[model samples]
Target: MKNTTLYKKFFVAINGSNSEQRPLSIALSGGVDSVVLLHLCYTLREQMPGWVIEAIYIDHGLSVDSDSWRAFCQRLCESLSIDFKTASVEVKAKARHSLEAQARDARYAALDSLAMANSMIVLGQHGDDQLETFLLRLKRGSGLDGLASMRAQRILDSGRVCIRPLLNASREDIEAFARMFAIEHIEDHSNKDDRFDRNFLRNQVIPLFKSRFNGFLQSVLRSIELLQQQQSLIEELTLQDLQTCCSEQGQLDLQRLGALSQLRQANVVRSWLASFNEKMPSKVQLEQLLHQALTSKQDAQINIVMGKGCVKKHRGFLYFVIAQDPPQPCVDVALAPITLNDGRALIVEHGVGVRAPNNNERISVQFGLLSSKIRPRNKPGRNAVKHWLKEAGVPSWQRAHVPLIFYDEQLVQIVGYYFEHSMYVPQQGVRWEVVDGE
Candidate 1:
């Protein structure tokens, strides 16, 4: 196979003619697809003098042959005079996720950590991979976002752009290129394991389709392109709706979200979740979420856990809370300022009408004092800590995490809400205030 078209497409994808300089890192897996991609990119480095070419091999440690694959990648990179790096990652397959998915996640995480800012990380996924992803998502009843499959270019979490320059090329094209160039590559034995859904599709389903229908891959690609366009439109509309539905502190206004159509509501919710880089909910989970949002009573508390986080509805707003360990108990407050487990600091400052702790008084910071009462600086009467938090517009999810300054058994002040004015006279004195650290 001729390399002219592939080289041109790769060059354009990396913006080879651009005057700005940025490094390009190829994700090399010692596979034919990646080897051909690396070779093509290496051949173009002379034309794009501003670009730095490098290769990264991520060893998931799932197989005994991983070391040999890493060595192959290193030797290939050395032969091409390109910088080589290897990251060893542990693949922890949870009960809910497959080993393949876990390995992919670990590999991408390693690659993201190895990538630099403003660099382009090249992947070797081809047209067949895209088709498999689409079919898998379809079988799982995915929405437009999943059905659209992978994109040619996407911004990663490390501020690096991931580009699949070979997305339009087929696996046969890659294999032919590898043979024509005499590129040395290794085959992962796991690829032949049909127990994995993707492998099963590649070995059994896809071949059956190819045998029965001419140009089936091309037809699938055309459908994917159309679905991608439709998905893009939905995303644009969701962004516009999200502006109206977003509330303070990155929460979503449930009332505003409810005003939209059901499909629009799901789109906005998905868009909101993506803003925080949260994993997308499954079809059933999403349906349940929409049902809860649309039908649940206004006064009822709603909390639904999904992935590593949860969707919670409180006070007419929706919040995504990442599952985290309980906040550690606050430490004893001495004369110096102390920081809390939630990144808030307890500071002692000298001010008028401030109450200074006595020598015998036990000074400390505490959280979740629901029954505690405090007389705010300007308020008329003592109010419950929970009520004050609600009046101050603090969400229910964050109320328990609010740091409270206590002198012995009495709640002296609530951080960011009330400081007891009557605790001390108007003189040069010391008071405690909680400062936001994040």
Candidate 2:
């Protein structure tokens, strides 16, 4: 390949200096594929003036060789006169997904951070990958959206646009380019381990088919392209349909939703939250969400958490919630200070606090209290909440969703949604407010 032409194509795919004043950060994994990507990107500056480029490598810390691979990548970047960075990630099994998924998630999380405040990150996913992903999705019986496979240029969920310059290029082409440039690359021994599904498909399935069919990879690529076009149409319709069917309460309009075939309903939900490559919900979770949403009561409020995010249904439309178990659970998630030493009056809601017992009387509180100057009535009217909600006609199940403040072992307040006047904060003593959303 002509270096200048390759550079021009890659540079333009990044949208160039004219389209974006921002620089481009390329993710280099030290593999042959990414090494070629780095070389191609390095040629960009010569092809287009003012095209800034940076390279980032995330050491996932999985293999003992991770450190050496990173060091090699750093040295390669240094020799090429490109700025390089090393980012480390810890991919613990934090979700109800595969270890591979978690590691990929964590690796990207690190890369996204490495991309810095503003700038797009480039990845090296060639045509071979696009074909394998298509087959994988097909084997799983996924819809057109999944069969479509990866795109060349798509804006990631992080609000950053990721461009794959080599999407149309074959793996053989990349290796040829690498060998031509005499570029050194690391071979991950793990790729030989067929334990991974993708590896198995590449080594076993694809080879047999390739031997039988001269251009199977090209055929698969073309098939995926066709599926992608059809998926584009479906995605367009699904987004528009969701807008009309989802209400302000973040719940779906069952009346409108029920009008569609069961398959269409599923498509609408999946497409609303996804496009060509937005991570689709798992089959089990998708089925559960569809069933619960379709079969539940008209006034039901539903919340299902999966992965790093969650889906909530309130009123008649679905809402996305981003809150999670805090990064430092002990420090940030646990806001209460446990308990105060001695008779120090503990502010009931601050996780933990302490203060001396006061003899003062006359308390002013909103939670409905008697002349008895208790700072907080101990769990009063908690049982009455179900009755109050019943009186107010709130369902039996929803009372739990409402935030209820607790004083140590006792329920002190049922915030915004409800408050039992019987349990009021006391006057002429330490003050405490009902806890709400954190």
Best lDDT goes to which candidate?
1
lDDT at 101, model 2 = 71
Q: Write the per-residue lDDT of candidate 1 for residues 178-207, one digit (tens) a residue.
A: 777787899989899999889999999999
- RMSD score of candidate 1 (Å): 3.2
TM-score of each: 0.87, 0.70
How far is 132's C-alpha from truth in model 2 (Å)? 2.3
Candidate 1 shows a clash count of: 0
Q: Local distance difference test, per candidate? A: 0.81, 0.66
After superposing candidate 1, which stretches have Cα over 4 Å from the reference?
1-3, 16-21, 116-118, 193-195, 211-214, 323-337, 347-362, 375-384, 390-393, 424-431
